[model samples]
Target: MESKAICLGFLPPRLGFSSPHLLSRSPGSSTFATRQKFDSRQTLLWNKPQLSRGRVVCSSSNSESKPETNHSSKSNYARAELFRGKSGSVSFNGLTHQLVEESKLVSAPFQEEKGSFLWVLAPVVLISSLILPQFFLSGAIEASFKNDTVAEIVTSFCFETVFYAGLAIFLSVTDRVQRPYLDFSSKRWGLITGLRGYLTSAFLTMGLKVVVPVFAVYMTWPALGIDALIAVLPFLVGCAVQRVFEARLERRGSSCWPIVPIVFEVYRLYQVTRAATFVQRLMFMMKDAATTAEITERGVALVGLVVTLQFLAVMCLWSFITFLMRLFPSRPVEMTSPLSELLNLDLSDTKKIIAEYIWIGGSGMDIRSKARTLPGPVSDPTKLPKWNYDGSSTDQAAGDDSEVILYPQAIFKDPFRKGNNILVMCDAYTPAGDPIPTNNRNKAVKIFDHPNVKAEEPWFGIEQEYTLLKKDVKWPLGWPLGGFPGPQGPYYCAVGADKAFGRDIVDAHYKACLYSGLSIGGANGEVMPGQWEFQISPTVGIGAGDQLWVARYILERITEICGVIVSFDPKPIQGDWNGAAAHTNFSTKSMRKDGGLDLIKEAIKKLEVKHKQHIAAYGEGNERRLTGKHETADINTFSWGVANRGASVRVGRDTEKEGKGYFEDRRPSSNMDPYLVTSMIAETTIL
Candidate 1:
């Protein structure tokens, strides 16, 4: 895990991923001074608007000492409508709107292809595993081992091995392209990851298969009898009634219907028992005619095979079915860390605590922090005093006057430290109290604090997408060190080992974000194997910026502890891959009311006029990522459409149908500053 997912201070977009033959260096541990220089320098700080080659050019001179808000430009656009004409100011009343189809809305929940039922494949795998051990070795095992420990050992080994093999074959999809887990034709790392993840699960099931039967026989022998089994059959009739109720409950995020499947399973078990018993009875009748007991042993073995098939079926059926259900959306699978043991230790005895002061570094994207001792628990951020840091080391000031002041603005629970110890989100300023150039939050605050903006109560939902890379090779986790994965097809929101990677880290960060009290809405596997996304949403004004940045800090901390790099690169890979983005979903108070759809469209019109400005703040190297292909609009154009991933702004179909709801700005890149992106969207749409 020595790998780091470098986003802020990483090299300019590496060349290798875009093409097969293109060569590039993996900056695993390099001091990446190659971060996009223009990100920090070529900001949206235009001096004045000018015409350039039949287009408007609004840019600042390179020699400017301090940044200024584009007051006049913003003022003009604030009073403008969607469009203007010779007669009067115009609107989008007659425009043909782009709408997303209902069919397209249900994308790959497990990142599988359209109409491809992956759960069916898992059941097939379990069936095959059952057959190979029972039928393939039935005669030899019965003769050699006499149904003893040797036989059990042989059967279990074969079952587990074949189960792993079957899973490897069935789960072979990552980044939309199909390649079996064992497909070493391109990358041997496939075999490595398969053994590490799937094989572990295989062995786990092997133990469960052994333990479940023993436990059932010992603890519930009477429950396995005919009377108990028969009672379950009548309850199965209530399935329709249960479904009617469960569907209603589904809206409230509850489901009793999952138990209906369990009932069906019990009925299946009873049927399997009857079929096996009938076969054993037939064998006994035939064996009675012979003097030898050999036929009876074979009869018993045949019954065992049938019973084993049921057992294997149940094991595979439940696992894959649960996987499919979980793919629908569940709480992030928080990994149990030994570090959590420390969080549980009694701390009621002490009143002293630690408070970590965190702030944006000179790079703006990089986070820097230092801890201070506190007398006791404190909830208010204003009560926390400001601190100083060596600004020159972080590229924020000259060596002579290297100190930068930290103004504590927000506070979150300390997930790592536990107890009343906290993490303070701070912004940088000079000793004289003037904001530093890299203090993006200060600019965001000003916009959010505007009286017009405050009245609107702009709300934002930011979808932050990112890729996880191996620190050593500087390649995506689960990706081949120097080669490519199967082309993108089924990886969006995909589940299973072959389809998803780095889920443990993703889940860990999710929990940590929640523990730290950020408004993290959700998390999911993305359109690439090692890629992922989490959402910070329904947050109003400056709190949106505060929460998103803190959530990111939590993710970075989690990844650092796990020893993997979490990349925020918009396009970590190149070529046919899906690039990462932080799709900004936004709405003002007016946009959520009736006829809000028109207000949304009007906002888009303003966004269109200032598209270039927004793009500049989106993220560095976004031009390499936002090509017109691969579910992205061309970076140079601005377009709004309903439920379109390729549009600059996407109005979901539900929003159009209801004539109210938020619109998503899909143009923001994975590495875009949330403070800048969220605030700018509010400024344009409201102020």
Candidate 2:
């Protein structure tokens, strides 16, 4: 008998099979021997099989006779190979073909499971149905006080425990219909995918049940027959609206949907509590009831009943929603990856150049910039060529014909631009390139580089305070209109819905300062509501004013988008409220050395001599802010004390303890030009 090999090609590993194999066997016998050669797709034959049995035979040459079974297998494999093209090959076998067909069937349902619009519409309908009947019952109870408590308690019990809970049970049993609409997956906390959803739902339910009814009783004390519907309707409508909005956001895979509802609810709760307290006082003063003691007892009982019923209703609704969500989970959404914005280009061998020109003017009131495309960046910033501008436009010259040359002293990266842009801080000079005699930045730089103090290396830390005001009413951004907010007691560094506002602007300014390399120390909410403070520290030479001006410019630009005005007014708001101040903390190398406290006192004494001059440049409207009230010194006289805010200059207590450190000039109003103030301080204190 001649030896023969049966080559059986297997499917890919994805179809759960290994490589092709060759089985060697004698003619007309089932017994086989293995000859493993898995590298090539083409099979080789050692010998031809006998034509005695109806068995398949594969041949290497076309001259050999082909068998029916082998021919069918070859055709199927050829078709698969053609479908995959030249880069791919497929080996078809009886088992592999069946498995591939079954996989298609298995994945078909998942592909067809795209979310439907009905999921969003169904919840809106259900919530509306629940709230409509409450309005009628509330109205009926408001009309008749005799049956008010019983009506409210029964209405709440029926809606919450009976109807709402029954609906939840119905949805849970028939989850197939409701699951698709409610399915969601939490993106932030992967370990507990739906944990936030659960917690938030629970809180919303609690506020509706316990907080609202108790608040109702507290508000309508003597009458004890207030309309619960009117108070609760807004809450119900708001919840329904929020749910609809959240569903839309969820479909788009927004992480913010879960947080926003909670914030709104908490704020609503606070408003309700506040209103109830106010109403109680109003009722008491009016003497609305014959016996206040009797009304109070009945009010307590009614509140308890109302709370119990409302709790049951909210619990039922929450349960229904939770069950539907678990049955059909939402698919993860694909988000766009954040790419770093390039701010500089590598053009070392390129011919093009880009630069930005920045200058200070308006009596050092503003820092302005304009882009200029140049042949190349300045080879030496210290020797930058002077540029000219219309000095009259910037309030620096007497007439329009007069022009001023801008002398660039320092250069920095323009943090807000998204290219290789440079920020040039320049001082004003006469058209002939002579330094402008009255320019504050030039004066500050000259004083800083004076021979008497040039070697001391003076450093400054300026604490800048300002307020954000709404554009329309001109009131502080977060303050209540037509009245004040809780007397401004709880706003400083406070973290809550009521106490903090305009944090987004503050945060943006801080980041901009940091990116600009401004040496900004930190920021915090100030004593008065809507007043905020930021500090710049260890800024040496004239760089202190340079960085401060840049920082202020960034703040003003960021607030412009929101129609918010940044007010550097010393007393943005008058009365018992604290005024804003730019307290400048200064230290020299000698002032920080041993026995520096005496040197600090000596500087203070010199400051006393120039009190009138310092106050004059401290900023306009200083007298309104620096009165001997609200942590301010008497503006008429100069006084220095250790850690005393109510003084002209406050010497740090640590400086007194260590016998060395720095002193803060607290008399500078918030609106003072930092350049002018620092210049005077250096001229008076550097001995």
The prediction achieving the highest lDDT against the true structure is: 1
Instruction: Assess the local accuracy of residue 35 in candidate 2 as a C-alpha lDDT between 0 and 100.
Output: 22
**Considering summed lDDT, which 10 consecutive residues are worst modelled in model 1?**
77-86
Q: Write the per-residue lDDT of candidate 1 for residues 570-639, one digit (tens) a residue.
A: 7776556788888989999999999999999999999999999999999887897789888899999898
TM-scores for every predicted model = 0.53, 0.51
Q: How does candidate 1 score on lDDT?
A: 0.61
Candidate 2 is scored at a TM of: 0.51
**Clash count list over all predictions:** 12, 2
Query: Residue by residue across 1-687, what tens digits does model 2's lDDT show?
Result: 001122222222211112121111123333222122122233322221221111222222322332222212221100011110011122221111110111111111111222233334445544444555556655665465456345545554444433333333223222222221122234422212466776686677655555655565455544545444433443454455456555644554432344334433443453344334333443454456656666665556445535533454455456445534633363322121122224344555665455666777664556566666666656456756667777787777878566888777777666666344566777778866677755778777778889877788888999999988754224576654223567867999988867987898899989877877679999999999988999998788788988887788778778764456788878866567888899999999999999999999999999999899999999877898889888899999889899898999998889999999999999998878888998889889985
Lowest-scoring 10 consecutive residues by lDDT in candidate 2?
77-86
- Tell me the alpha-carbon RMSD of every candidate: 20.1, 33.2
Clashing pairs in 2: 160-313, 343-419
List candidate 1 stretches off by more than 4 Å. Answer: 1-347
